[model samples]
Target: MSDRNDNKPQTPWAKNLAIWAMIVLALIVGVSLVSGQNSGSDGTVIAYSDFIEKVDEGAVESVEIQGQELNGNMTNGQAFVTYAPDDPGLVSRLEEKGVTFNAQPAEGRSLMGAILIQMVPLLLLVGIWIFFMRQMQNGAGKGAMGFGKSRAKMLTEKSGRVTFDDVAGIDEAREELQEIVDFLKDPSKFARLGGRIPKGALLVGSPGTGKTLLARAIAGEAEVPFFSISGSDFVEMFVGVGASRVRDMFEQAKKSAPCIIFIDEIDAVGRSRGAGLGGGNDEREQTLNQLLVEMDGFDANEGIIIIAATNRPDVLDPALLRPGRFDRQVVVPRPDIEGREKILEVHMKKVPLAPDVIARTIARGTPGFSGADLANLVNEAALLAARQGKKLVGMAQFEEAKDKVMMGSERKSMVMTEDEKKMTAYHEAGHALVSIYEAASDPIHKATIIPRGRALGMVMRLPERDEYSYHRDKMHANLAVAMGGRVAEEIIFGYDKVSSGASSDIQYATSLARNMVTQWGMSDKVGPVMLTENQQEVFLGQQISQQKNVSESTAQLIDAEVKRIVEGGLARAKEVLTGHEDQLHALAGALLEYETLSGDEIKILLDGGDINRTDGPKPRTIGPATGASAIPKAGTRAGRSDGEPDGAVPEGA
Candidate 1:
């Protein structure tokens, strides 16, 4: 009964009509039963004397007697009923009167009652049949017929609000896609120059880089229809369902020429054809094949543009990326510093921001944030402001939001024993102290013994600036900083007293060391050789890999190299922490006292000063030289500082 007609086969009006008809039929049947009961009780009631007079006068057309009741239709065509006394001569009286009468018992079922009981169940069966029939026609039955129908959701002109201006970051990709918008708006502009619009432009990026948003922006800018669907939509459990859907989608696209078709996460169906264990007969492969054919079959001059977005472009079929198909590939990488600033501004438009909030500062601190991350960061800041009942979101709120996003929500409800708290304080202090001294390490921004996220305590360092590539010293310094806590523990509690709290730290350092030797070829022994082969689908967020063509001895050598690097970093960490033992103790005490410390307070403490920094001796320079002198001893496979093996150590010793 709604004004809008749904594309679904089941119409609401039809369903309502069936329901109303069932109600009306039930009402009519009920009324008929009531009227039948009333009719059986109709006619006039008479006393016993009146009945006798009628019988004697022979005015009754017919008479019936039963125990104490008499009923008859008179000779004048009048109907009457009367109650008789239980007299033995009642039947004889009727005989004497010579009236056409018959005696009957009163124990038979009513005709109307029997008819209603049978008819009610029949009507119920009919109503049930209609209900199921409509259900079948609505979805299940229609599904059998609609397997070939496109599932893409079409957006009218007004449905989309995103335009090119609304999308920030990835400037190069934005510029590359601008022409497609122009082509959609006026195809003749390019045709006059004997040029055809690119058949397709594939947007490739890591997740949350705004690839799908860019596609929607293109549609909005072109002011054309937009059809959005996921790659999985074309696939179904049936073998050929995917191919049929692909064909149907193209057909619909042709009808809406000058429109855009955006298939997000295209890698779901477009993965390499023979990559699966099932071989080429897989439904996904078939769907991908049909998609290739449709892209090839369509004419670019017809003004239809297909834009597919996928994070795993490396796994896509080659045929789908051929020259005549998706010839243009755009990389939508994570936003850089300026790009992140712009993204923040875009998201901040609706937020009531205090004047002190600086996007550039936040952007600088967030080195590898994507556009989506920046938006979430801004929104989180706004939410924090609202939670605090503030009129405007301030810079402090943004800073808090960033911490929450990076580290996680503060776990205020978590309780820790006094000994555990002290141990955590020392562990975080060790990290902060080492980060400040490591030349290649990022600056220590904050340190806290207050539990946050899954961590009991944390030390956070904000990158000074974004670096596109990592240097050898930076990696080495990062490893040493990661091991600093364990080293500090070793110095304080000795080897046997170390806790398992540094498990995550050890894992991170080991991964870095392994990557250096295998993937990065940074190991002196590996000599720029790739000892490990990364799978093509690394962009899928899974780091699956296999060893390259190498002998077992070579693999052992690689493992030894990784172990050597980790030990060297650990030795360096031990040297730094041991040399600055007093400073480490001071920092840990400050953390224990306050439960949290800002980067500025840490810097002051590192300068041999207190938190207040009023009056204290000028501190020694905490530089890379604190542990730079340590080196591997000759003829030793282990990390040796002055001819002594660096044993496995606990954190914050």
Candidate 2:
């Protein structure tokens, strides 16, 4: 079932080796023949004197040569004749010393060979047309090609098994789509009261928040035919093909009315016109134009609602989002903590997970995780447990799986010299210490020097369970936590060198700082004014919004405020770690040996070496006092005895 669904529409492209061999042979033969023919006949070839004699007269009706007719062209002042005489022995009889012959005209056979030579080009043109037709036919034969491809996967009542029950996150989006479901189930309920179904609803969101899932749910709950296609399907190499495809798709949709047309990534086609990105006449523009015409022009009674999903709503054309086209844009953003917990619960229900595996704990650990990430996390845990022949996925596995999803799998084998290893250990230690000590900060989970994905080291922190709202102090604490790594390195080693492993950390911290000044209005100098516009490109091949409505002094002030916030966090981190220098050295030394140490292990050292440090790879060893909540322990370097693979927690995954 999975295989069939994966390769749906059944566009079978079985290559015939014999046929390809024949095509290659034909191409080689054609090339050779054409090359030789071109050499033989570049232009008209005529006998110089013979053709000139005929040109003196007007359109020589016939040539009378010694009272006999002749035929040729008068090109280049010559008439070349291709006539072989009737008698085989005539060539010997024609060369008498003093005899001279003159020509006048010929009858039916005049210029026949020359005409055939001119027809060669026409023959080649016909051959080219035939080849193109064959190619088009071949494509058409394989699952409807040459014409526009409607990627719309159709689902009937029986096929669409997914319903709102299957979707866990996105309460707001679910409510909006439920109305559509209500309308589809009973159209006349609204019609009887003199109301019309919305012509279209644009589902807008960041990727993987279950927009497509909701569309399917509607198809399931409404029990109507659903046609799913992507916006990219409309674009084609040939001009006007996209427009034609748009018309064809609508025509089909109209016939399959009372259905849903779910378009994934509409921004691919419905981008703003004259953006000069693809000049106005590109295939996307044409498709978008046709779509606009169809959407507004269609009767509301058609009941063929359109749902589009995209991460970037700003790039979409205004026409497509306007009143008559898409009546509402349903936002399916990253789920909050409760939504995430529900999502996690749904994904884990089928897996052999331990009863103690707290979904809320996992959800809080993943601050920005989407539905897709949660799904992947469940799979990862299951896979990890299965590989180790475990009965159930424990919290340890889930924590590791979460890290695998966010930071990528741990790079346990990344060999580092003693000096580099120590630096990274101290760096991550700084972050962990800051988060642990900060009043507004979330709990720390794990601090590691082990290479994971792109970073040489990392500090993982877990927010409070079911925490949705963000306070300014908490945001500042998070940024400060991010800056602590660099600060630790700078404070001890002097501000000589810093690796860009902290690039993501820096960008995130800077954005938060600026947002506080501008968007969040948490700054003193900025005075509660929103200034998200102050964002600017900080690195290569990046786009950042310009800092708006300020002067040089204000810019300096904003920079100072950001520096002050980060510095305060770093100073706090320094104070915490420095005050406990003996513990810091002890932790870094252990990191030097193992390249990674769990929060419990660090805490055991912090708490004067009280706990059993030798109890290897276990679950949730850190309690409320440890402050390592945000760290993903399941995908941690210590858990599962392997790195995170594919950011997906696979069952036995």
Candidate 3:
């Protein structure tokens, strides 16, 4: 038991106590040495006149004088001390009184005491300096003298290791990187076929699509030493520091040949050099230059392979992506419906799911979710179930979590007047009614009068399948749907009483109409030529010096075409709403009663059937439509007189 206790790790508190104890012991020793120099001053003191009377009466037996102070033994065998005045006759009086005396020097600090007092502060300063230097070395992988050394860390398998089995939703990217793994494992296999392993592979995709994870899987599959560094680690304020670090990194990689080096967000240093207004960053460019040489210079880095990930591939330097440097570019795009199902299954394994939780249904609902989004969805569902003290995550929880993730969480605590509620119901009803009647519009997934995010009400629509492009008819239908809310408000409340809730709707319609005329070349008047310039970064010098792409007459023509398209859609919406005013009132009344309604519920209400009936008609499938998923408004508060209705469009609109 004693040995076991001794071998146990010490806590931080115990270590601190031991260090303090050593410091206190050193202070005690120093104090004792200084005190030792004045050890013989323990006798009782007497006045000078009393000392003179004692000597005259012959009470002093013997005396020792040091400067003006005197120490003597009384004739009664007691010790005493006294200070003598400036009297040269004191020694002669002592001799007349037959007292034996000796002369000595005055008391002062010893040599050792003086030295200890001076060394304490110097020792503390040196200790503090050493402590800071050690901290810098630990944090940067180098002290002040080694500032140019590489900060790359060699990854170890102490944490649960990741492999290809753990990756999903990106099979193509994984397969592309598989060749690199094979080459590293058996170089002779590829050598016999006269094929050289590519020097590097670049992973490009939107964020959270698993670019970094793919790199890790490659390293794991090959069972080679992995060195990980961030691109920003090479840059510093001092000139040439970045370049020196890059060279040091390659040297370390060469020592561990046949290993893999992974750099994340390489665009930080690999951006196009000298493209800005005032040339470019000197340190960053030097670093990039050194990196380019190490990759494909005269001296070949034969056994080492480099893999880098970046989302902004367009901003990177051209030389960095050449065939000799990065031979392969693997795209890790957001997962499709089937791929989403696979990803959902991978994340679902960690959660305890109920019988009604279907992966396919969830995947179909989350059309554009990446792998990270799917994982978060599962975690949210599990958390909801835990909050309710349930044994497993149910379909109901998953549905609620999806709504919370897609829309902003519901704002149930917000207060509103009855008039505001009525207005919101009519506004959403118009959107739902137009979607139901439009042949090319997407089917309504759900519509609600309850406040969500910044909008007082919203209508969410989902496509039957993922759409890569939009048709002309679909775009027109989208325009009509976007205008429906404002059009409905104008018809029901009169033009003067219309609310500002349609601000977002109008903005969406305007942007779409302009893009159709200017970019997609849908307007016959504008012809097939693009009238707008492509958006680029502000740092590019050409953006400042270049002239407008369109002439004055062409610009006027483009604006006129956009106005024509938006008004056509608005007229179409008005015609539809005027012909079906009764249905619009019915939808609004149902929303006031239910607060929320599903597509099936709305269809039943519209068909003159009781939605509360247990045996109501089955929901009919609607045709595919192209429109934004959620249209949110800014002026949700009641009694606001602001004319501007701030609205927002969904992603990829």
Task: Note the residue pairs that clash in candidate 3.
Answer: 441-625, 442-625, 504-647
User: Highest TM-score, which number?
Assistant: 3
lDDT of 1 at 253: 71
Q: Model 2 TM-score?
A: 0.64
- The whole-model lDDT of each prediction reads 0.73, 0.64, 0.77
Q: By TM-score, highest first, what's the ranking?
A: 3, 1, 2
Q: Largest lDDT belongs to which candidate? A: 3
TM-score versus the correct structure, for each prediction: 0.70, 0.64, 0.73
Q: Please give the distance, in angstroms, between residue 152's alpha carbon in candidate 2 and its true position after superposition.
A: 4.2
lDDT at residue 511 of model 3 (Cα atoms)? 87
Off by over 4 Å in 3: 1-143, 365-368, 373-400, 494-496, 524-529, 532-564, 571-582, 613-653
Residue-level lDDT tens digits of model 2 in 1-653:
11223333333233334445555565565555556433323334444343443444332332224213233333233433433334443223333221134444443433554565556566656666555555665522223345664546676545637888889879989999999888988888999999888888988877788988888788778766677778888887777878887777777677667777888888888889998853675777878888888888644436678877888789899888897689998989888788988998888878887877998877777766778877888999899889889998999898777667665676645444555655766666667667767788756666655444444556666656545456877776776676666666665666775544354455556666776776677887778876533446555677655655677787788889887776665666667766766666666666556545666766776777743446543321110100111233222222221332311111110
Candidate 1 vs 2: which has more lDDT: 1
Please tell me which model should have the higher lDDT, number 2 or number 3: 3
Q: How many residue pairs clash in each candidate?
A: 14, 47, 3
**Please, what are the lDDT tens digits per residue for candidate 1 over residues 127-148?**
7777666654443224556676
RMSD per candidate (Å) reads 10.1, 14.0, 8.5
